[model samples]
Target: MNMSDILANKVVVVTGASSGIGRAIAIRAAEHGARAVIVSDVTEAPREGGEPTAAVIEALGVTARFVKADVSKRTDNDALVAAAEDLGGVDVFVANAGITLRTDGADVPEEDYRRLMSVNLDGPLFGAQAAARSMKAKGKAGSIVLMASMGGLVGAGITVAYSTSKGGVVLMAKSLADALGPDGIRVNAVAPGTIDTELLRTAAGIAEASEGFRKRTPLRRLGQPSEIGDAVAYLGSDLSSYVTGHALTVDGGLLAVI
Candidate 1:
């Protein structure tokens, strides 16, 4: 069981990789020995103020390139996967781009709701579609990792649109797994709870609410981007060859007590 080079020689595509959990996932893929890491996002600049994700990954002695993409657009997803062909096609596609809207079902604006759903839900769906098609065309049994949320599994009035979208992501993974299984393509998801990221820090009621998140989690602390990164790396690697249609939770036991 020498699993040291888990994702070794794999070409991994990660979306929304400019910052946060997406950035960490791309970096971890390279660290895990991926042949090429495709850092796809609307921009290359990091939101938390650091070097771009591609540069950070390249520093790990791995092939890394920044591919500008808006995952919400189907064409962008297709182009992103096509870009992976330059590196001999994608071996793993991590649909990690997502957003949250703090609005209830009744109060969410139409424009805001559409944008949120397009990015949070349609992004992953289209990404998976394109990636799966590429994998099938290449006759490769690739892995697809969708980013779900703890909100997906549980209901919350504050995150109505967000939770609904992620809940779709959860079922989407399972449905995709079942459909793509015959083709040897594996589909799964990662459900993360409150993580310490720039996005979370900037949320409303930051200081007090962060403490509340900590208290609710069994681990008594917010999860880290790297933790989710490691989990996704596992899902993308050979270590999870037999795992599919599953939602791996990296929430520090937050859902356990809930």
Candidate 2:
């Protein structure tokens, strides 16, 4: 089947799409023919060139809307769902918003822990819930893809809170899949190894040993957002009708090697 026709006339919502992996997924979804793409972030206002990803989607012939909503905030999550409903209906919801921070037990503030949990862990949970509600209400039988990391799958150094938060997301996705499956809503998670996004540049060890990730990763380089986008597209499309409650790793074989 032609990939471009996979998502024709479907509506997709992507969070954290101001840049990075979220942006890549949004653009690719539109390219595959999603009727309307909601480019969500934490900023208000929209523009023709409001976002790099949305710009490309519009250029490729799809209606893209920008909605500013902080994933951590319940009201924001609601608004995101409302935005999609306003556009018509949502067939895919990409829970791609997240934040990262590092701190030792001694120096870590309670607020820091709270903030990370709110975004990394809690955000996806609430987003999935909202999407489920929308899908159930509309009887849309949709797809929801949660973004996770190697941190979620394995222990990384020093960032205990960040690692734990993503781990929660992994389970959250599975739980949603199990519960939503009866309603025909497929839920999945994408755990990418290391990518060249702005988030990776600021990550603790990645920037310090840029070459280390390359050498350690079997591919001998960082993963790309476009690669993750392809995986997301598959999961969101009919191609993955039988796939649910799975953590699809896009780590370039990093997890395969010792």
Candidate 3:
């Protein structure tokens, strides 16, 4: 099979598919000839502005569906998985929905922290559970890709809650891989560093810190969302069949110096 067809005929479900990294992943799956690509998110509109992810996929002559879902809720996650199973069994699940707060650790508000954890941490936990259950019931080995962040491995002075939540996701992937391995399900995470997403551009102090961020990285640049998508596609495909519990970093070499 061709490299682009790594996920041919597979059913893929992506959370936060409305935009940014999630949108890129869903589109890439369709490019890989996925039988059905389910785009799950709180909204159908793209955050950075453009056609909805499902529309983009369909325009590519691939099967795609949009399922409105709030990943923090278990019911929503389960329903999203069911929707994917309806199209075809889910062969790959990308838990890419996440949020962040830009407050200093000492001044972080309770509500902000809770909200961040709910989406960033709880989202992946529920998504992984639902996808694993479906794969197990169908008697198929599958892949689950959780979205972690470079913040999780390192530290960000003002992003206490966001960093903590991503850290939980990294470990969650590891623990799930251990528990699900016996059942033939693989779990992993992609940690992106300073991706050029709208969210990052609008992040507090990011504009002022951009130069410093670039200078510290060996690549001397920010990563693109599509770059992270490519990493996720690899983890979710047979190319990395023997890989599990690994956190693939898609950073532009930022972590190397840090």
Candidate 2 residue spans exceeding 4 A from truth: 1-3, 44-51, 102-107
Worst 10 residues of 3 by lDDT: 1-10
What lDDT would each prediction earn against the true structure?
A: 0.90, 0.84, 0.89
lDDT string, candidate 3, 3-93, tens digits: 3888887899999999988999999888876778999999999989989999999998888999999999999999999997667679999
TM-score of each: 0.96, 0.92, 0.96
Highest-TM-score candidate: 3
Best by lDDT: 1
Q: What is the lDDT of residue 185 in candidate 3?
A: 95
The residue pairs found clashing in candidate 2 are none
lDDT of 1 by residue, 1-258 (tens): 212578988999999999999998898888777889999999899999989999888777888899999999999999999998988999999999987665446687888889999999999999999999999998999999999998899976677788899999999999999999999999999999999999898765443477787998999999999899899989998888899999998889988995
Worst ten in a row by lDDT for model 2:
43-52
Give the higher-lDDT candidate: 1 or 2: 1
Ranking by lDDT: 1, 3, 2
Task: Return the TM-score for candidate 3, rounded to 2 decimals.
Answer: 0.96
